[model samples]
Target: MSDLAILKRRHALLGEKAPLFYEEPVHIVRGEGVWLYGPNDEKYLDGYNNVPTVGHCHPHVVDALAKQAGKLNVHTRYLNEEILNYGERLTATMDDSLSRAFFVCTGSEANELAIRIARCATGGMGIIGSDATYHGNTSTVMELATNRKMGGPKRKKSNVRSVPFPQMYRAPKGMSEGALAQAYAAEIQAAIDDFEKRGIKFAGMLVCPIFANEGLPDVPLGYFELMQQIVHGAGGVIIFDEVQSGFGRTGSMWGYENTGIVPDIVTMGKPMGNGHPLAGVVCRPELGDAFHAESTYFNTFGGNPVSCAVGNAVLDVLEQEQLVEQAAEVSAYLRSGLDLLKNDFDLIGDIRNNGMFFAVELVKNRKKKKASKKKPLRIVNMMKEKGVLISSIGADRNILKIRPPLPFTTDHADIVLEKLTECLIEVEG
Candidate 1:
């Protein structure tokens, strides 16, 4: 069948609301490290996928999956060494206090379970999330996905409070970094105080420590530390949603590592199984123990042997290849190239990056910093025509998201930069 025919069939079944990228969506049939192959055997640089972190169809991970499936594929109810070992490996990477793990299939499930544990352990009902954030699709998690509504009127639920993201690029006028931190921190405190005023117990806060969805906004120093104190003082836990920003995406093992505020609960997915459906919530052992005593929970497919094997293989690849260090090294190189592009292009208003995940903001008038998502939209479609893949982020959708796999090298970045230059020129024209 032709590409358009296939796409029409897909839309017939999936509905119009189902999201697909590009004005002319390419029929991607295969993938390798940081590259995708279209139906006609055309190769496109994959610069917008962090899900296949170690790389697409990695040999080691595929082998592990095949071997485990041939031997056994059973739930965690049985004595499974793979699950146990994978859990140990996962928590070993977290803070010492966060030593327990509960497996789930998606980041949504992980986050939902994390909040439940928080409410169970703390006996509180109020939760905090950023104004532009996406936790998951589940009803409870969707309430926290303020980005889904694109900054519209938020849910009237008092249990969930949305805070303005500490975005330095969009910080209020006349505010230095220090004052910005103070102002953002003060907003959080006020939210907590409002929770108290309404007689709502402070359950905890759910935040993307790296703020990946909000175009990976530059974090304000001292803000996390101050918020940690306030939340804990009010007897609440901190839940870090590391679905996109964790797993070495931000040049660190964990997003909270540089923030100086260790999270009480950490929910991870996407890159956890390196393209497989594996994810979970990690928390302090005591918190899990307390929750377990009151309630019993189990997922049939979660933490099974096959998923565990895939997770283990992903860790193995990350460790053996030192992809974390590679990401850091290559990101510096890529950063320099992006900076050069910014120098050459007047449309680039700002560049925010951490590790391989970077956001390039396009503006109509750089002097006024006037954002125009239409420019990025044009650039996105143009880059597609040039065999490069990237997308936009944020409510305005003006920030181009450049997140290739971990194996992406400086050579690949060069192609992206060159093609992006051509796209920008066309947009300028």
Candidate 2:
């Protein structure tokens, strides 16, 4: 059967919930480092994906998986040294107060459990999330993911609130950088006030330190600190959804580190196991105590031996390879290159990046007017046809998201730039 037919068959068997990106999809046969090989043996430079936090199929992670799978892969019901060690090492990377780890199989699960813990601990019903922020796909988290169209109605009206995202490029009039930060904080405070008037205290504020999927917009300096103060003052916990920005993706061990604030809870995934199915929530010990006292939570395969081993190996490889430092160094280089591109391209409006996470916002006529999403989508498809892989996002899909793995090098960036330039030229023409 053809690949399309096979995919259709599989989707049918899996039910109609499966989503397809495009009608016709290139069949990726293999991946190594930052390159993906198509069925026709076409080599595509990966420039817009980072789920493989390390390069795709890093040998260290592969070897660890093989070794652990051969030895043991038991569930969490059984005590295992690998689980204990992995948990300790992972939590050790965070603040001392965040000493407890609750493992799960995906970012969605981690966020779902984190919300439960927060609500239980705070004894409050309301949760606040940023506008255009995506947390996860689980039912509970879906409510918090204001970016998804389906989330609006699924969200419980009384229990959820959304504050405007702090996109500096699109800040309100007269909003200076300092004032923008203050206004964003004030928005959160106002949300708390609204909830208080309704007799609904807040459980927590869920945020991404550097908002991903919302155009890779970085929170203004002092934003999180001020938000934390507001949440704390209102007796609400602060939960950092680091599912995309964690594990050194933001030039730090954790994204919250860059914000200079320790969140009450943090949900991490995607890069934690370097593509392996592992995610976790680390919380202040006191919160953990309260959560555990209220309810027993368990995931059958969350911290299984194999998953723990893979998680540990990812950490080992990150440190041994100094990939975090590499992200920091390469990010600077990429940003400089993007800055140059912005200077040259009139269509490029704004460039925002953190560590390896970079975004290029395209504009229509260079007067800072919003660019049509259709143009960026066309550019992305053109780039893919040119043997380069990148993706477009933003509320309008006008921002090109360029988040390659940590192992992506300067040379890789140059290749991506060349291909991107070709696509841009074609689109411009």
Instruction: Specify the highest-TM-score model's number.
Output: 1
**Root-mean-square deviation of candidate 1:** 1.4
Residue-level lDDT tens digits of model 2 in 239-354: 99999889989888898888889999999989888889899999998899889999999899899999999999999988999999999999999889889877777878888998
TM-scores of the candidates are: 0.97, 0.95
Give a tens-digit lDDT track for model 1, residues 46-101. 99999999999999999999999999998889786888898998899988999999
Q: Candidate 1 has what TM-score?
A: 0.97
lDDT of candidates 1 onward, in order = 0.89, 0.85
Question: Which sections of candidate 2 miss by over 4 Å?
Answer: 1-17, 154-156
Residue 230 shift from truth in candidate 2, angstroms? 0.3
Best by lDDT: 1
